[model samples]
Target: MNRKKLEALQGWSFISPALIVISIFVIGSIIFTIYISFHRVNLFTGYYEFIGLDNYKRLFNDTKVLIAFKNTLSFVAVVVPIQTFLAMVMASVLNAKIKGVKVFRIAYFLPTLTSSAALTMIFMFLFSLYGPINQIALQLNIINEPINFLNDAKVALKVIMSMNIWSTVPFFMVIYLAALQEVPEAIYEAARVDGATNVQQFFKITIPQLKPITTFVLLMGIIGTFQMFDQAYIFSNGSGGPENSTLTVALLSYRYAFGQNSTMGFAAAIALVLALLILVVSLIAQKLNKSDTLY
Candidate 1:
């Protein structure tokens, strides 16, 4: 073989393990999922029969599926911006040279490193009817009695949303803090010399420079919020309780596949729809980022 052919063979050998792993774990899984989505499968029967789009049709007409879609959208709409903005604010605060800055950063990031399951347990206790939160509210005469936060359809989902924000903000805050460190200090000094106040320098200089990081964080937040399974599952105890107010697309898909109903094919279709939704959202986010860069 020629020198070029030998080099090509060596390169392939180096990457072949990764390629094989991805083909089996990622590509193969996706193909298998798609195949399953076209078949009718039952729990008892343990047999799959090809049924071409029937699962898709069922998912379209399923009321719970519709509710799940709405809840997922609402969760993303509320959580993504709130989490991202709060992260930015936290990043700004920590980016400043202050006493024990390292400690503050570590404290802020502690929640992200801690167990989410444990956090959910603490939140559940705090949000319970007679929990400390409601006790304070009662002392303040905010309500006649302790309110059932997780049991009320109106407030259950919102409580979960709040939990999500608290748990996730730390993770994104670290990202923003890393990005903020990369921004040149000379630009801020120049702005300050031009009679710009702190707020003015932050809005005009810091924000514009952090645009790329903001875009990346926002995209990640959207994807994370859309695939929100842990918080929802923990908060609702896998039922997405209080009349399905907190039912997310991910939780709904799981229920369809293995919960009370064994509609594996329909669940697969839902999974595909969710994957497509994320893809479209990611594309749109990229386009918006591109547009922002032009200016």
Candidate 2:
């Protein structure tokens, strides 16, 4: 072989061990999941029965699955937009040159660094009926009485949504901060010379320039929220309790795969559907992000 070809072959040989492991574990697992999604198999007994699309078809009549779909859709709809807006606003503030801004930036970014499970526990404490949040609200007479946030079906999901928004905003804020650096100061100055207000300059110049970054934020937010299992599992204690208000697709899939149900095929089908939902939402977000309507 030529010297260049020989060197290329040697490089492949070096990485082939890692590549083979990933293919078997990651790619092989994905194929197996899809395969099992079309069959009924006992994981413990190694008994496999081919039942084509039975699991997928059952999803149509499953009430819990329906609830999970609604809750997940609601979460993605409400959380993504609010988080995107909060992140953009926070990033703009941090990107500004001001005294002690760096300190504030670091403080704001701390929540994102925290583990989701830990954060959920913290939020649960804060929102508990006898917790500090209710106590403070009572002192100020803001609430007529301390509401049981954890057990209330009406507000349980909202509490999770708020906590999720608070935690995720800082991470996306950092992304927006990086994107903001790419905005040319000259454009803002030019807008100022034309008597464009700060708000106008923001809408006209800053946002349009950061369209690609916004797309990235939306795609990430959609995927993350769609597959949100950790926070929901922690909050509901894996039961999706208080009337199944907090049951997400990922959490439901977990219940099927490993919970009392032990329906791995149904779980795999749910996961596959969730993946497709994320893909579709991301493509739509990308198209909207590229549009010139707002600009």
Candidate 3:
């Protein structure tokens, strides 16, 4: 065999084990989930009954499912834009190489270093009725009483939204930071020569150049926020309570799969639908952004 063929074989050999493992675990599980979605399944009793599209049909009649849909869509809609804009602006600032920039970077990135579950717990404590947030609000007379952010239907999702934004912004900021570093200095100099101010250059040159990164930030933000379950689950204690305010589609799938009744088929169907929703939304966003256009 030629030396080129031998080198290619070696490369494949090195990667083949990981590829096989992924095919078995990730791909296998996905196929199994899709199969289960078409049938009634009970894990404990090994009960399996063919039900075809009945589970998907139940989605229409399930009020909680509809609520979860609304909540998840609202979360993606609100959080994606805010976080994307924030990340870009913050990246622009950090790219300026100011004094004490390292300290600021570390402080901003601390939340991203923490695990999601840990962050969720900490946020819950901070936002709790008797927690420091309310204590300070009370001290400042921000309200007549302590707001039950956790228990109020009107504010529950908003609390999660705030936590999500705070935790995720730094991570996306890092991505934008990297992209900002790649912006050619010549481009900025050209803009300046054309009598463009910093703000004008940012809006006209930097933003346009960072379109690909913006798309990535938006896509990841949408997917992450759309699949938000851990925070909502921890906040609502898996009951999706306060009038089902924090009930997310993922948490709802958990309830269906293992809650009062184990409707595995329904849970799988819900999951499939969610996957499709994420795919469709991401595609639409990419189409709108046209991030693949060469600069």
Q: Using TM-score as the measure, which candidate wins? A: 2
- In order, candidate lDDTs are 0.88, 0.91, 0.91
TM-score of each: 0.94, 0.94, 0.94
Give candidate 1's error at residue 199 in angstroms: 2.2
Candidate 2 lDDT, 162-238, residue by residue in tens? 99999999999999998888787888889999999978977888778877788889889989999998999999999
Which ranges in model 2 have alpha carbons more than 4 Å from their true place? 284-295
RMSD of each: 1.9, 2.2, 1.8
For candidate 1, give the lDDT of residue 10: 100
- Quote the positional error of residue 192 for candidate 3 in Å: 3.4
CA error at residue 199 for candidate 3, angstroms: 2.6
What is the Cα root-mean-square deviation between model 3 and the actual structure?
Answer: 1.8
Locate the minimum summed-lDDT window of 10 residues in model 1.
286-295
* Per-residue C-alpha lDDT of model 1 across residues 1-295, encoded as one tens digit per residue: 9999999999999999999999999999899889999998885778889999898888778999999999999988998899988998889889998889889988888888768788888999999988999999999999998899989999998988898899899998998888888888888888878999878876887778888888889899999988989888888889988999999999999988897659888888999999999999899879878856412
Q: Write model 3 residue lDDT over 1-295, tens digit each, in one string.
A: 9999999999999999999999999999999999999999999899999999999999999999999999988988899999999988888988886999988989999989998889889988988999989999999999879999889999989999999999999999999998888888888898899999989988998789898888888889988987888888888889996999899999999999998789999999999999998999888977877636426
Model 1: how far residue 145 lies from native, Å: 1.4
Runs in model 3 deviating more than 4 A are: 1-4, 193-195, 285-294
- Model 2, residue 84: C-alpha shift (Å): 0.5
- Looking at model 1, residue 65 earns an lDDT score of 92
Clashes of each: 0, 0, 0
